[model samples]
Target: MSKIDVDSVGQTREGTFKYDWKMSALYNLGIGA
Candidate 1:
């Protein structure tokens, strides 16, 4: 939960690039699995 909050803050501060990358990576991992 804490890590998620940090990620959310990062998304806000760093913009969408890192967020999108993380989402895409998770999506691909889910698909692969």
Candidate 2:
């Protein structure tokens, strides 16, 4: 249904955001070190 599709998209976006944030943090730490 449309609701399920919306939920899935939201979840995917949130997951990607979290992953990108973690990656950026790691990259910054490596640069600092």
Each prediction's whole-model lDDT (CA): 0.70, 0.69
TM-score of 2: 0.62
Estimate the TM-score for candidate 1.
Answer: 0.52
**Residues 1-33, model 1: lDDT tens digits:** 466657677366466567767778898998995
lDDT comparing candidate 1 with the true structure: 0.70
- Give all candidate RMSDs, comma-separated: 3.5, 9.3
Q: Show the colliding residue pairs in model 1.
A: none
Query: Per-candidate TM vs. native?
Result: 0.52, 0.62
Identify the candidate with maximal TM-score.
2
Model 1 misplaced regions, further than 4 Å: 1-13
